[model samples]
Target: MKWITHLEGGPKRVNHAAVIVGHKIYTFGGYCTGENSREYTSMDVHVLNTITFRWMKHPISDLNYYENDDILPFKRYGHTAVVYKDKVYIWGGRNDRSSCSNLFCFNTTWHCWTATKTSGDIPLARDGHTAVVWKNYMYIFGGFEEESDSFTNAVFSLNLETMRWTYIQTTGKIHAYIID
Candidate 1:
């Protein structure tokens, strides 16, 4: 395993999601425990410059539209994120309050978030799903829905160039190859 030098101001708990671009690590939406209280959602965005290993608060901006307003991925955990071209895409995750199936993208050049729309075969809302960029397509697989808390093995792909979705079937357990 490669050793990743610890970055500062990151959530200490496991399962929180994040994405990295260039040298800056951007973390938005995570769950953390409050002082002698229950777990709570976090909207704080943290930016860390990998080269200098410095951390700072990121400013929010309107760059994307969903439901006629600027859309930001809410505080979530177990979400999946990927970077394509110059944008970072974030997908479904769970939180103390709810689970999400929304998708949002961050434009590195513009430094803002934009919501993506798909026309057909949208995957159900889930958390812990894996999103990976294969060539020009974004492949998503396996996540648990909040209502069921049950893990899934569904595999789907999105053509980023065309913005379309294609569902793919697997022969065996999805976790088989995913696990060692």
Candidate 2:
């Protein structure tokens, strides 16, 4: 693969969640390393337009509201994202202090974030996981669980329609714990 160079104004981040919607590639929160080599999680959204090959930062709205209400998800890294319809759903990630179990959605059309309410067997707070959407469900698999202090290969699925999570049982020898 060839690297695209001179793409200025793009975010330099790691463990971020990225998804393609139309011709734009949307990237959400991750750890940003600065000139001093200090790293910190950023609550920012960057978008790359494939046609123009340019990056643009999307500003967050209602910053004041976020402080008063739980409207936005915290700055996170090692999260997983999937695009379903017009919105991108992000789940599983952590900042400096702790991991997260809440699911947040970024509306591409509206350019806003929403804390989605979910029910059923919500998986444990985790990071470094992967997610994909199939049919009407979003499947999340494997991540590092801080409470257990170990890697997990557990699989869970969230139904987009009902906003319910279900633990999926796996079969065969493919089941294995994650390793660093």
Candidate 3:
């Protein structure tokens, strides 16, 4: 494995979500806790070019608005992001303060962020959840919920075409974690 180096000019974060589209890795939401002491929950977008081995800041908006005029998502970690077609879907992550279940979408084609409205039984607020994309659906399972001091065993599915959510009930292979 090759160690990725020289990402110093961009955001320094941990627990950030990263997904690759084409030849680039798009990183989202991470906390910087060392000397910089920065919290990057609802911050900016950064890109790492795998081919060139360089890091660059990406614009997360269209040409219509400036940073002072647009609204974005909150800062979070342990969130999951998946790329399907031309869009990147961002869901559930928590920061030092709170957890949220809101869904945000960044259009790679348009270079804009759009808040998504989901239907059906929405999952509870969580972090560290694992999300996987298969075909046209996104499957989400288990995460740590700080408010209850417990881990989750629930499964949720989101339809990419319809933008709807559904809680799936299963009897086996339920995702869970142990707390001490």
Candidate 4:
């Protein structure tokens, strides 16, 4: 595995929720500590040029496409991000105070963000959910909900083309234990 290091200058303490695409690493909403020591502060979208190892802040004008200006998915942590069809999708994470159920998509081609209005049954608000892209669908499983403060074993799938969501059923423990 090849590792690269770069310096980011901003809030001293920020939550980490990001993904890597090509040579560029994109980090979405995260919280940071203020000079006054308040928490739950939201941060803007930031990008890192892997080749140059430099950080660049995204334009504020483009942020609207992501969702609500300041109120949307602001400075969230424990959220998950994945790149599909060259677009990045972020969903379900905790901000400074509460957990969210919003889903946002970033289109690299347009250099803008847009909120996804999903049809069908949507997953409940959660954080720490693991999302992975398999074929044309994005599969999400296993996460903790702040409201209940409990771990969930539900599985869900998002159809990228139809913009629909559906819950998956599992029998028994759905275990994949490997014994040697």
TM-score of each: 0.78, 0.87, 0.81, 0.77
Per-residue accuracy of model 1 over 93-113 as CA lDDT, tens digit each:
766667777678878788776
| Per-candidate local distance difference test | 0.71, 0.85, 0.78, 0.73
Residue ranges of candidate 4 with Cα displaced over 4 Å: 1-15, 35-43, 61-72, 174-180
Report the lDDT tens digits of candidate 4 across residue range 1-180: 765664665323355567788898887765455432123433357787878877787774244423465344455767788899889988888765678777788787777666788888788888878999899898899899777779999899999889899999977856678999
Q: How many residue pairs clash (N, CA or C atoms closer than 3 angstroms) in each of the candidate models, in the order given? A: 0, 0, 4, 2
Model 1 TM:
0.78
Q: TM-score: which is higher, 1 or 2?
A: 2
Q: Pick the candidate with the highest TM-score.
A: 2
Best by lDDT: 2
Off by over 4 Å in 2: 1-5, 35-42, 61-69, 175-180
The pairs that clash in candidate 2 are: none
- The residue ranges of model 1 lying beyond 4 angstroms of the native Cα positions read 1-8, 11-13, 35-42, 61-70, 147-149, 172-180
Model 3 lDDT tens row, 1-180: 896665466677888899999998888867667522233334457888888878887755222233422346666678899999988999888767778787888787787787788888888889999999999999999998776878978899999999889999889664569999
Give the per-residue lDDT of model 2 (tens digit) for 1-180: 989767889988889889999999998878776522222323678899999999988877225434634657777789998999999999989887889898888899998778899999999999998899999999999999988999988999999999999999988787458999
Better of 3 and 4 by lDDT: 3
lDDT at position 106, candidate 1: 75
Over the full model, what C-alpha lDDT does candidate 4 score relative to the true structure?
0.73
Candidates sorted by TM-score, descending order?
2, 3, 1, 4
Worst 10 residues of 2 by lDDT: 34-43
